[model samples]
Target: MLHKTELEYDANNHLFLDAYHDDAQPYLGLLIDIHGGGWFRGDKDKDADWATRLAQLGYEVLVPNYRLTPQVFYPEPLRDMDTLMTWIATSDFNQMPIGVVGSSAGGNMAVELAIRYGVPAVSLSGILDIDDWLTQHQAVEAAPGDLDRFNQQSSAAINQTGSNDAFYKWFVLNYFNQRTDELSAATPVHRISATTGPLFLANSLAEFVPTSGVLKLADALTSVQVPFVLNVLPGNRHAKGYLDDIFSQITAFLATYLIDQRPKPQLATE
Candidate 1:
């Protein structure tokens, strides 16, 4: 069964959450699905398909939307997420094994949630470092009106092999609220430490968010000996395209922590 309702995760943010659960199968866990529109666009409906699929896999899927950028800013969205989780803790979903599946910007939030709260998470073609992303785009002479195209060229950058797609660049720029210096804090790669939780990150070689950021995250996790899996696929697709073939693999990984609640794999020191 699926239902639509408004849940106020924060006093200032009321999320439109589309929830799905299968009655035939016992509920395994709560999986929050976040959509990717680069923090400025997107809504619950965008991720409804993925959410319902996860629900069919026996987990309750909740796809929620938060405040967007230029209007709300970076930390505001993160704060809204914090409120969402806090509300969940006090509601019917309290303490149930929780996980997150996010695409792009949503992936960034999901990873932050996992790092902050110690929950398991998976990111599909997410941007790990916005600063690095901006730098890459600038190197290609991309600007505010470039759309998904790298330069002022008529062709979309995403259509070209090895080129990146960053349609949300303007949104991200506004998310910083004109204070670009704050981006360092918003960049997940910079924040990742030894305490970060189990993560499954998959990226397509031909997409926007550079594979370099993913590699950097993997390296940091490895340095701390954190248990994680980084999958770099050979393709020129973005978020949803990268997800089509990896659905089963992701569900299995979610099952490891959400259903089985496996003990955290110890690092060499731990």
Candidate 2:
């Protein structure tokens, strides 16, 4: 069974949740699905197909709609996500451990949330570094408004005092929240502590954003002694088979971590 409901967020942000059930036994607490649109466009509706599949597996899923770029910049989405998670924690569906799933831009944000909140997360070809992305976008030499309508926050930060790397003067600012250190802090690898939960990150070697981002995150996780799993499929799309693989692992992971369906003690031999 699947049900849809609206969730409230800071400043009248209306997020939606798609509830799923199968066999009645709770296999998960709550699942959050974030849509990717380069931080500029995209909606929860696009994630419906994936959410629906997860719901059929008996997990409650929330697909949040956030204010896109040109209207709001970095940190806003993070705040929006925080508000949604807090609401879920206090809501009736707050029974099971929360597992967040994200792809592309959303994947990047998902890693940040999991790290910041100490929740389990699965990132599909997540974009970990905004600086790197902007470099690829060629926003540095391009005219303003090429990347974002707002002031180039990232570019300005990197070259505040007019340091070299002329191209660095036009970095992607919306995602980094105008803070370089925040990038380091928000990164899943940086957030990894002994308390950090398990993570499953998959990327395609052919995809620059997801592939390089996953590599960076994996390296950081190694340095911090955090438990994480990385899967790189050569010649694959960013979100290729994402719904299938993510849902499968999430189901089993939830069963192992949340349900605790241990066997009952057997009666003494008669």
Candidate 3:
């Protein structure tokens, strides 16, 4: 009952849209799936099953492969997703409400996308602030093994083009751009505004990404009165096995929030 297809992309290499629709009728809605492998590894195929389930629910789906770490960094991922959303607004998918679902780093990107572009987002334990890990401050220290994984997988490593210290400087410079103001720019906490769109957050109580990040995000949304939902699932391991109950809750949330909003009109402009 679902049809699959690819989305042609532009020269910037910002977007790739893989879609699914019903065989007998047109697509009723769309969800963009952003995979999370700590911003370094993850692809559309890895998320196809999630997309497929949404498609089965009568919503079209797009799983885009964006520039990854060790190749691109920071704003590149956010920019890629933003451009893709703009492109989607002009495709056949135009005229339907758009929703995005991201995990881990992708979850961070999802919240950032909604903050910067006004797209509705559903994040499953996403990294909301890069500074929570990058800035070598006296924050909650990561365990030794976890720190090793962080070093290898953090988006900052994408720009490691020189010696260790130099690469770190490049990562920090590229991220903060030599200005203190830019620090906030790179942090989703700094981007929150009253106009920010809806966010549905799901966090594993056991995940070390910090419950505080989710709490901070939820507080901001609440302060600004942006429509949002937060689900803290206790005892679940860090983004562990596909919990069907969580998935069902996510699908229901998307259906309720996205079912009626209209997509952009796709009339070609000469």
Candidate 4:
């Protein structure tokens, strides 16, 4: 009963998004699932399965393709997200409650959008604090066999001597074009304010993305009094790797804010 439609969002850039939903059911809300590939690679199709699953749950899911690094730099991808939001606001689904879920780089953007629009969001292994992440990597020495293990598991080709943390740092630098000064502005942990919406953040205790950043963001959200849930799993899995195990919790969190909290129509007292 699931249906999917691909629609263009940015014609000039030839960017498009896939919409997934069940035609037989009323949409509970709109959930945007952003794909993640360290901000340098990845496409909307990467999240098709996740979108379909969400759609089956009675939510209209949107998976968008945004510009990546090398072709574009900091804020360009975020700008594309802005365009998508604008498009949604004018579309037929404008009035529906909105929530976002993303992995890694996409998770970072989800938090950004949540901060911008005050909508509920979930970030899975998001690189929340770029500056702190780089600093931490620089401060610590890689453990024995860490580099080899990372290279063995990574899909992207990495030098034999490179650790997972180093590879992550390379991509982050690439996304920012090495403008270290600008990293703070793009760091979601630093951007949190009182207006930021509820967020469910998850990260593995020993994942390549590092748990330190997630903890920092959690502390920052606390300081601002923004409601959030931090789930730190046990393993080296990053982002989508541990998603299946925690998916139910993710959906429950979304439903709490987007569906359960929504105002219900009053019944007539005839």
User: How do the residues 195-231 of candidate 4 rate in per-residue lDDT, one tens digit apiece?
Assistant: 8889999987766677777798789989999888999
Q: How do the predictions measure up, each by TM-score?
A: 0.85, 0.73, 0.77, 0.88
Counting clashing residue pairs in each candidate, in order, gives 1, 2, 4, 0
Clashing pairs in 4: none
Q: Candidate 1 lDDT, tens digit per residue, 74-146?
A: 7888887887888888989885789998887788888988889878899987767678777666644333433
- What global local distance difference test value does model 4 have? 0.82
Q: Rank the candidates by TM-score, best first.
A: 4, 1, 3, 2
lDDT of each: 0.74, 0.62, 0.67, 0.82
Q: How would you encode candidate 3's per-residue C-alpha lDDT over 19-119 as one tens digit per residue?
A: 77666655667778787665666677766766777788777778888877667766777778878877877777777788888876778888887887677
Error of 4 at 125 (Å): 0.6
RMSD of model 2 against the true structure = 8.0
Greater-lDDT candidate between 1 and 3:
1
What overall lDDT, based on C-alpha atoms, would model 1 receive against the true structure?
0.74
Candidate 4 lDDT trough over 10 residues, lowest sum = 151-160
Minimal lDDT window, size 10, model 2:
150-159
Winning model by lDDT: 4
Candidate 3: residue 237 lDDT (0-100): 42
- Cα lDDT of model 2 overall? 0.62
* Clash pairs (backbone) in predicted model 1: 165-208
Cα lDDT tens digits, model 2, 67-179, are 77777777787888888877777778676667777876778777877687767777776767555544465534522233342122111121122222222222245455455
Task: Please tell me which model should have the higher lDDT, number 2 or number 3.
Answer: 3
